[model samples]
Target chain A: MDSDIRLLSDLAPGQQAVISAVHADEALHQRLVALGFRIGRNVLLMRRGRWAGPLQVRLGATDVMLRRAEAGLITVRAA
Target chain B: MKRIALLGMPNTGKSTLFNRLTGSSARVANWAGVTVDLASAKILLGGHMAEMVDLPGIYDLHGFSDDEKVVRHFLEAHAIDVLAVVVNATQIERQLPLVLQARSLGLPLVLLLNMADAAKRHGMQVDTARLAARLGLPVVMISAKYGTGQAEALRVLAHSLDAALEIGPARHAALKSVLSDDVRIERETAEMMAEAVTQPLLLPEQVSDRIDRLALHPWLGLPLFFVAMLVMFQAVFWLGAPLQQGLTGLFDQLRQSALEPLAAVLPDFVRGLLLDGVYAGFVTVAAFVPLIVLFFLFMALVEDSGYLARAAFLTDALMGKLGLDGRSFVMVLMGFGCNVPAVMGTRMMRERPLRLLSMLVIPLSLCSARLQVFLFIVSAIFRPAQAPWVIFGFYVASFATMILTALLFRGRFRNTEPFVVELPPWRVPTLRQVWMRGWLEVRHFLSRATRFIVLGVIAIWLLTNLPAGATPGSVATLAGQLGTLFAPILAPIGIDEKLTVALLFGFVAKEVMIGAFAVIYGLSGDALAHEFARNMNWVQAVSFMLFTLIYTPCMSTIATIKIESRSAAFAALSVLWPLALAWFTSFVFYQGMRLFIGG
Candidate 1:
């Protein structure tokens, strides 16, 4: 992965980043977009559960929890 | 009547606004997709009756998800007079694209800036007039939670309905210019937010964030969740016990003073039917009303506080291991209250396979009805100090069965949707909302389960008293014969003929199992305990509780599964799978304990 593009799952808890792209299927991609995870939106990695658990991310005023595999589909750059 | 639909993104207080406008107590949580189906009620707007439909929350009208499809199909199928687009004012930027999409559909629309109080608290000043002018629609700012601008919104809706009817087909032709691609829609929404919404440049930490810092902590969060659940269970028992006891005593008094006197005037069979059959059965299930109410109260509080989403967040990984999602975890938790609603709650999941899988596992959740039976057995078999742990063990087993069932059946279903859940801002639950929810749930329970319970009791009574000469509930009666027929199937699990008869009645409702014991043994309270102690050892008691924990779901749940899944095969599998699992589990427990303890 490029320096500016890494999986959202790789972001440390409490780290803020901007979503570069969401590389998932049409359904998942649309869901992410519907949830305000559109390109260039600032997302904060709020919390990561233990043992590779779901990653809680904040998009705008909304907070969402996504599984690690799902989070891995979103590429982001550190903000 | 004109049809006005309440449309909004998920978690935007659309259902709450609907409740406020229509006075219908549809389930409202601080999370998304609580209203999974279309709910409508007739409301008097300006002294004119209009049917107000509460559509499932959707982010975009063009979206392909189940809820979105339902909303789209509803709009396409029905002639909606007005579209009330509810926007969470605090997140207006993210919500505007949907409003734009609805605008493109050229329905006479009214934009409701809901949660205006929360918006102000967040230091957001939504320029509703400018946005309304820009979108060429009526915009009303309202706080659905506090009923601040609902009347104004309704007035606007009525005016817009009349105005749109005046404009008629011309508006659709002119609106073609407004319809654009997603990119343009996003751009327009961004520009609108920039021009209209004013917020603090640097947002300060919110109460919800502060709480989530601790509640969602990877290490402490899980334990805190468990402790919170334990407290809820304890509250259910501690708060409910006194009320339960009082109700029981009151019913007993009523049976003796009010019902027993009927024996002098009424015939013997009539007295038996009224007092022993109807009254006993009703009271047995009715006594758990307090416990069920408290359970739902605690659940409502947790759900309203937004902790359920966090709990889902915490459990998603583990649930993913079983090919389920975190929302499924929440549904299973709800199953502890009742499997019927929990199965219905599966509609919140957008995916078909996940919904079906969730429906399959929910019945094994050891609902409050089954918990009542276990509580009876535990109180009778174990010391008071040990009773909580014994009950907790059953809960643990229930959770294990839920997870194991999910894992076992995962291969049968395809995993399509990924885990995605919104964490709504935590709000202090109001007493009125809590009371209304608890009351509604209790009412629902009574309406759905009571008829079945009474019918089952009448049937059992008839069976025990039949053939004219057979002793009631004795080995010679019809019930006894039925019990003997099922006895061999239950014998390996250490259930005798009497208990077999009780389990058979339990198929109607689990709470009836305890009542069946009372009727068959002709015992209650200490006498019932003494009888159980004489007939069964501790190992058998443990095995019996385990068997009850995993056995076939009560009759209502099976019917719900059939209706909800629209498949009789799914319902049959639900029953057969649990019965087989229950038998195997109890057989193991009984054999293992007996081998070690010397039966």
Candidate 2:
């Protein structure tokens, strides 16, 4: 569990993982899901911007940029 | 009547979904609020009708943004029968919160997971029933691109409406209370995904790796980007040339054959006015109509096909260097077609400073109207040998000016409001969607251009027709008097009377500049060529050309800027700032050239 716990940005670009859980509220959750962060799907972190603030992740190749605050909510484990 | 609203984050294929379900492409984009207007259509649902309204995409219902207000107030006031939250299947996690929020709205909601084909290709799977049960709504996975599962989604929506009437007592509740149940629902959905869903095999890393490698490599990427931009511009210029020629030929023939015969029956004043003013004005404006239409076609293709997001992503590095926030790409792209839409598009930028700065810089982007002027002048003056390069140089100069100005204004905007843009999977845009969208944009431009050009030509004719009409050197000869009034101010800028009058009328609409030029030179075939060499002189002509290329955007663009920025001051600044910069730059160029040439 400790080894699996890492900042979502730590995932290699285009590597797959599942959103084990999310910490944000229902509104933020829905927004995240709207951006393809739903649980069980393989999420791929594609590109991260300067200072790792906003990153483009490929949730099945529909790439989207998400802020760290938003990204932090999606707890993922390498599949 | 029961109302069904389509809610989604910007660019989640909401409009595409709307089009697929309703069969109309009201300008879908990978960017936000491509459908700024709320468009509604009815679809037959299980022997009944469901009225669906496409709401503007807003990140939060809490925000004061126009789109947000549309969704927020509607939910607050009206009892929406069904809400179709069009979640981008490829980017589900981020899309989920909107669904949760929509759930809080207490509508009978159906989650339409769009972009599933792209999602599945990336090795992702979703348990539809689980997601549906978890959110306490029916969830249907569909690909808007392929129009798959759309009908099922609609059918589920039909059931939801029926369920709503049956379960009327359970409709209203606090969001917190409702979400407490959704938590349990989500837990069950997670289990459902574990049992029922199998993640598909995504193409192994190399394709994206190679593309991203070349696309983001600091040195290679910038040159590639410029080449790509040049290619797009070249497409706009060269590909549209034939169509433009054809349209021009049509108008020229019409003017000669139809209008020429009609001229004799009319009184001399009416005849002169028709040929010299109205017919001539339409020809000038209409010649560019094909070019505008083609450019819009190219624009819609780039946008709908997801190349725009790639451009945005690739140029983010350069944009950062210029101190423009991440969101300025949309505004800049909008500027290429017309600055007004570009200025208006800046409203999507959450940062006040970024929006304001975008408004200011957008007018300088050399829109289609200025492109017309550049093509006309450079072609007339320099010939094929030098025209393209000179025209390209103006683009480079404008680009340089935008970067410099944004750099100067960098510190003004400290931070951008957090931006999250979904890049829909790249696909070839459908011909039907592209053509319809292109036609709409062209229609908008033509209407605005024609209306403005008609009044403009008539007014200029009237002003010039007064105080001893058309007596050789009389002030009543349209060009002579207006030219006289404009001469003193433009003299220092190296413009003579003929060029001065054209530039003066040019401030009204850039398209009007052509009509003004034709009017000033008496509409002869070689009129532009002769005036450029004789009345304007090389230095003044070049100076005037540069000034016209950079100055205030057309009236339609000004109106668009006002709409997009949601600020009168920002809109006025968009017009004033560019004009001031163009004026100063032209003055410098002309003065420096005069001294250098020892004139």
Candidate 3:
């Protein structure tokens, strides 16, 4: 992995990235992929809830909120 | 008649489309299923009657969610002529893969681009004709909410269904190859979207983002959510109380002026049964309609505005600590209005274990019905200044009981499905839509609750009136004898022989417990309160309140749990666990308080 690349959770709010890979438990991996998270999809970190809650990300026009623990498994590259 | 099923991802305006096509009420919600699970209607299409079925939405066909499984199983089991796949035109990139997957089913397919009006406003375009030609499938751009190109969509749908009927095996064989390689679905969806639709690489500065700044703020979001909930709950009470009073007065007038004079020819006993027994129970339930309407009205506003999901996000951290997810928070909130719909609303939850756990704890919520009982009892004993404090104490107990129940049962139920919820953009709910949603819930409450109330009251009337004139609720009557026989079990909870009868009948509806008091003791208004004040002390009152707060909420709620969970064992557990908890808690409180106060 490139030094500039990081987990999707590390992106600051308002920062954008492209999902490089999704590494999760088989069920979660399927869910993420089924929800349009692909290798090359661009994602913009929208916001996070209080006390390390879910992170909201804008994948194209759709916004989804997922737990940060799930986001940690998805590696992303800075856009 | 041919069946055309409208299938799609969640919040694609599928219900709006169903309503548009069939001219019926599908009970629209921006959030997931609080209304009809599978709404079907008959429509005359191409001068032939056809069934238009709307199934529950799913994020993916092969997903693990119960809804997804239902959709997949439904498609395989049912012989449907056409599958009309609806896509949010604005979110085609995220939605198109579902379309591709649905296409793989080898059904006659018609692509309906819903929310085209919103897509247009967002500077997006989908060339439907070109896309249809490229994919070799019929596509129509229609905004289901705004009724744009609705007729064209229906016409194309009818043609697709007829074509499927005529070509049958040949068309299925041809369409089987439409999906090709499963691995290439993503790339194909991307390439196809690039060619057919033009959407902004970035959303055009959504209003949802601006509001979400504070609503989902790292620091302020959780507190703000509590504040929003507090306001919603209090608003229902503060607003509904006056209307309740007005309705009460109106019913009183109607009975005195109309029922009395009209029934003057009847015997006094018959009139008393009509006026005091059945009519009073009816009045209690009917007078509560305003509160239920307001409660659901605010619920619709919060849900339709899309803040409910935000609250879900905010609370997921806390809920996660309890072995539940954000979705459970929403169900618990709905329980505040009424546990029946809240338990039903658990259908949106994809996983069964968490949904079952939610059903168990939801009845523990201090729902408005429980609150009604508390208010009546609190006013009877506590001073006006102390009323709020006592009720607030019960609220605290409600939360504690909910948390405690979750903590103790969390091990048995295990954890929840991952919470990856989509936050739909805020759409200001129209008054008509709000009213429709509210009316649907109110009708649900009335239909299920009124049955239980009337039947329960009639049963109580029989128990009181039986054995050939036992003085109607006297010691010799069935109800009174039954209460006394059961009095030993309730004695620790500070509920007496007479209040015991009311509690037993209260399983049907808690709101009628006070009315039952009038029948049991043959007292009303100030006299009933005076009777209570003279008989009970602070310790006993508190114990009684705690017991009522935790017991089986109502019969309809238990029935909803049984039906929704589809497990008689679990439903029985739901009753037994709460009843046991109520007894234990009340025993501890009643005994401990007696020790402290030296009674």
Candidate 4:
């Protein structure tokens, strides 16, 4: 399976996965790296909200909301 | 002191996060790109001061769209302390691309995994520490709703600010190894999001789906939609009454106490300018203020509650049938308040042809200014009960003109892009946001209308006062000469020479249409409405109003179209096409109705 870090939202709550792909351009790639998304991160989904928008997850000691459309591009696997 | 930039895709809780952090509800929703400009505020985090810049939501830094360029420019110019890349935890795969892109900017980054509680309920889990180590940055899980994990996110954010962390250029090579060649680092941000989000669970409470089943259905939906539109139209006039009366009375009193006293001290020319031009202009404009308020209040309610999007979806298929994009519906609804903003709102349509096409058709959308004209004439000529239906007829005429005109245009230049819009999640609207938005709309109307009305009234006063001692209908009088020129065109519509001129002036500013009619008819035996009724029968009065409603939009609206569409020819076409249709429709209605009713 594709392990794009952006696709962490595809996993069910408590399901863990590793990012397989980053799926974007040079500038975008640099920006994402500066934001902490990189190859080989173990991403976990913590919860989902209305319309699959504003999803929460544990990335380090922080949580974030992910738009569903954005979440669809990432390829991941069950851990 | 430190800085935090709240960045995310449209409707990804960035605003909610801002609200949570700043205690200001700056319009958070499930929809995307609602914030057009960056809004910033101060906050204290982890014993350090900070300024939070809430940038507009965008998918990527492609900078193709105007909004995208704005975000990119802001990021490029500002020397930020830390980039707080907020992402929806439920959809991390897609959200991560933006995160990764932001991280690659070589800033100290702290990824906020917001909406964690909802993700957990849906059976998704994320490991923060491991992901942070992998990404080589700090990450925190947060539920902007439940207020969980905010402190941790703030602490991590503060730490990143102090560290001045920077990602090396080799990160792109690392990203390429993870995804395909086509999958750039921008796409990498959301890789984890794609893996994390599950499909939404089905529920019985899908009101939009239920509404769409009927509202988007081919045969029944059109007629039902028409009926619903009629009800809303009727409701505007019917429900807007008490408030109208109260406001009018207040203005009337203000005119007596304040303006009348000021008029006394001024010289004759100045008094006329102050009293007739300024004060009277205010009264003319103020009468419609309540109507604007009520219309916008309802519109705000519709907007905040997410029904406006559903309406767009319901009408998309029909609009497509008419060769208009679903986005055009938004511009049209805005037309009900004013056409200027309707023209500006056309920017939301990305497709060029559709944007131009919508701009061409929007001025014909029967704005609230024209509604005042309709109400003025209808109340004077027809019975109260019959008035609603008469106004309803004009509303129907505007829509028909739009449909027919679009059909004609499409036959010449057709566009076939499916309106693939994502309906935002429904939210329980907060009254604070609704009222603030509503008040802003109300303020816009008041300021825009009053200024134009004052100038228009002064010009009308100058024209009437000119060719001294000349009565209306005389060749020497400027107003009379203009009325005479427009007379032949309006004769078939059964409007008098004076009213013909008034209607022509109406194109300059709709409020002036009323004030000119007032000056012309008020000079004679009665009010403009009564003079209209006395000169022409009820059928003709109704026809005259219908003509005004469907005619060219006011001067400001035309100018706005020029700016928005960036083509003078398109704006000119918008004017002439509608004027021709307005004439033809009025002629048919007046002639056909008179024969049937035996006028």
lDDT of 1 by residue, A1-79 (tens): 3566688999988799866656666456556766767544578998788777888888867788888888988878766
TM-score of each: 0.70, 0.65, 0.68, 0.59
Model 4 chain B: lowest-lDDT 10 consecutive positions: B25-34
- Per-candidate DockQ values are 0.36, 0.30, 0.35, 0.06
Off by over 4 Å in 2: A1-4, A10-33, A38-42, A48-54, A66-79, B1-218, B246-250, B253-258, B469-488, B524-526
Cα interface RMSD of each candidate: 10.8, 10.8, 11.1, 13.9
lDDT of 4 by residue, B1-599 (tens): 46678888765676567767875312221213222334566777767778887776678855345456556656554556777888888889987888877766666678888889978998999999999999988889999877899888777777776665354436434433433332343355467558886433322346644654564344565567567667766677888866666776776678678877867877876676566655665565677677777777767766776656655655654576677855787678778778888888878666678887888778888887888777767777888898898778777777788888888897655764433344454545666767888889889877777777777777776666567667634556787777678778887788877777677678888867766665555331124456667777777777788788878889899888888878888888888888888888899999999788887
Instruction: Give the residue spans of candidate 3 off by over 4 A.
Output: A24-30, B1-207, B261-264, B379-393, B523-539
Q: How far is each candidate from the true structure, as Cα RMSD in Å?
A: 16.4, 16.1, 16.5, 16.6
Model 1 interface DockQ: 0.36
Tens digits of per-residue lDDT for model 3, B45-163: 88798887777667887664656655655664456798999998998999999988787677888999988988999999888879888767999999877798988988998788778
- TM-score of model 2 vs. true structure: 0.65
Candidate structures ordered by lDDT, highest first = 1, 3, 2, 4
| Among all candidates shown, the one with the greatest lDDT | 1
Give the alpha carbon lDDT tens digit for every residue of B93-131 in model 2. Answer: 886887777776666778899889988999999999877
Docking class of 2: acceptable
CA lDDT of every candidate: 0.79, 0.69, 0.77, 0.67
> Which scores higher on lDDT, 1 or 3?
1
Two-way lDDT contest, 2 vs 3, winner: 3
Better of 2 and 4 by lDDT: 2
Give the per-residue Cα lDDT of candidate 1 at B195. 100
